[model samples]
Target: MEPNGMKCAWFQFLIGFEIMSLGAYFPMKVYVYTHDFEEGGKENPKKIHFARIPVIGECIVLSNNPNWYKVVLVLHTPYMAADADAEVWCVKITGSAARKAAGYSAS
Candidate 1:
């Protein structure tokens, strides 16, 4: 009975390993945001809590409107394109440093 239990455990482990090797599981991506113009530059202000979403590609887009300096981050899974599921990250930049990092410009 003890040997059979060990065998069952080993078989389960092998099955899990095979599934993982086949890429059946996908991990979520992480992104950090901070205010650079504050007292600590990069170290002064702590990062704020942000959202988490499934992703295949992640990037930031500069606002097209010249009057607004905003960064739009889109997190999406290409596999779900047929389903049209995507999430957007909205962050406001206050100082020039943060703006520059976010590719935000008045021009």
Candidate 2:
């Protein structure tokens, strides 16, 4: 096999491994949400809100603390395949200060 072909094979293997690992470690319910935005006009102002829905096969990792959770937003694009597309966009519902003040306790 050519060098590039070999590299691509290895890359795919690594990505599969990481995704399996994540699934094993942080298994939880995943919720899909979307936001709608309307263009503002003189007669009507724009309003936007995010609504949660169910998406199949989406990975969701729930934190016991209600602050931290892992959400699988989407598959990594081809450009990011080298990194195993394992990069997950993390969101913290609780602010950092609050966590620090609580000594990093969920309670």
Candidate 3:
């Protein structure tokens, strides 16, 4: 309702969208995969099973309002006894001694 008897389209449009709080923490569930990188390809029985994935820290959030997280942390969930490899990942990782002999070089 307006002075001219017309609805305010701009006001209605602004109300339709939602804004997310920047620094909010929420709980979420993550998948745990078995440490079976052998024969690396899709459709392996080892990869099919899903188990409890514990979160030692709060890198995830669960909210009723949809959020858009620009930076995503996609984990190729490791089967290690614990998430200890996180430290090693921050450093340089090396392959077999014969990696260069096998025809792979650092670019």
Candidate 4:
């Protein structure tokens, strides 16, 4: 094969490989919360319990916000409900609302 023709073929192969690899990668990010924060619960000092704890790979939202998140980790201390802390983690879903299958409602 001619040198120029070989270079063109290699470039095309690289583009195809990159496109396929994108589906396997996560977006790089560093999150920082604003000074405005909500108390984690309704009562005094926000001691709280979750009625339905989210499992890994579940989608959830924070409060009444429209934003959606995919649950990544949940470390529940069943004894800590009466304490002042709770833990949950999720990856933010940008530009997409929660799926109906994730149990969100229009109302």
Candidate 5:
């Protein structure tokens, strides 16, 4: 796997959440599909099989904590792929003082 893919897998394992497939590498931004898992946390192969809904964001460097990260995701409207309106999301992982402050989990 590529280094980013490895990092994605590690992040997935560390947080017990699926790492949605990402778009091409962009400086400071990573694009990801959001519907890879079902409401109950099970992998939804059907969703994976269908169209992808990608969102973009920058992940903060976690120099002090190798096991966690913080991502600021900018989501599009209708929560679909390329809807064009943006919404900022602050996601805190294991190291942050904010502590995953967003009430919602990775979708």
Candidate 6:
């Protein structure tokens, strides 16, 4: 039987591989920014965030500063089931030094 373009037999085989090869891997990072600006001479603060979708992980970068920098988010999902029925999601965040320093001052 085939479901969602995936054959049952293939699903079994893939699931086996997924289970056996479930291990941590290197993470990846990315930077994102917004074009929108806030009132005054300063740009609006962009909401920086990231998320891992069912099958596709996304990284969103946002900043109020004119110079936009890419912030990479690295994550690892161990033992990801490949049964074609398994649903998993993960995301990691890495803030810049500038942001951290500013946050410290604010606090």
Superposed Cα RMSD, model 1: 13.3
lDDT assessment of candidate 5? 0.37
Ranking by lDDT: 4, 1, 2, 5, 6, 3
For model 4, what is the alpha-carbon lDDT of residue 11?
97
In candidate 1, the residue pairs with backbone N, CA or C atoms under 3 Å apart (3 or more residues apart, or in different chains) clash, namely 40-44
Q: What is the lDDT of candidate 6?
A: 0.36
Worst-scoring 10-residue span by lDDT in model 6: 26-35
Predicted candidate 5 versus true structure: per-residue lDDT over 6-58, tens digit per residue: 99888878665423323222122223222312244332111121123333333
For all candidates, what are the clash counts?
1, 0, 0, 0, 0, 9
- Model 3, 21-106: lDDT tens digits are 21132222343222212335222111212123233321221234332111122354345573322211111113332244347774
State each model's CA lDDT, in order.
Answer: 0.43, 0.39, 0.28, 0.50, 0.37, 0.36
- The all-Cα superposition gives candidate 3 an RMSD in Å to the true structure of 15.4
Q: What's the TM for model 4?
A: 0.37
TM-score of each: 0.26, 0.25, 0.17, 0.37, 0.17, 0.20
In model 4, the worst 10-residue window by lDDT is 28-37
| Per-residue accuracy of model 2 over 1-107 as CA lDDT, tens digit each | 57998999999999999886775565432222322123221222112122232233333333344443223243332363342322333333335544564578645
lDDT of 6 by residue, 1-107 (tens): 45765677788899988765543232122222222233233323322223322223333333453443322333233444422222222222334534564465422
Cα lDDT tens digits, model 4, 16-47, are 99876763563212121211124342222122
Worst 10 residues of 3 by lDDT: 84-93
Candidate 1 residue spans exceeding 4 A from truth: 24-53, 56-107
Every model's Cα RMSD, please? 13.3, 14.4, 15.4, 14.1, 17.3, 14.4
After superposition, the stretches of candidate 3 with alpha carbons farther than 4 Å from their true spots are 1-19, 39-106
- CA shift at 2, candidate 5, in angstroms? 56
lDDT winner: 4
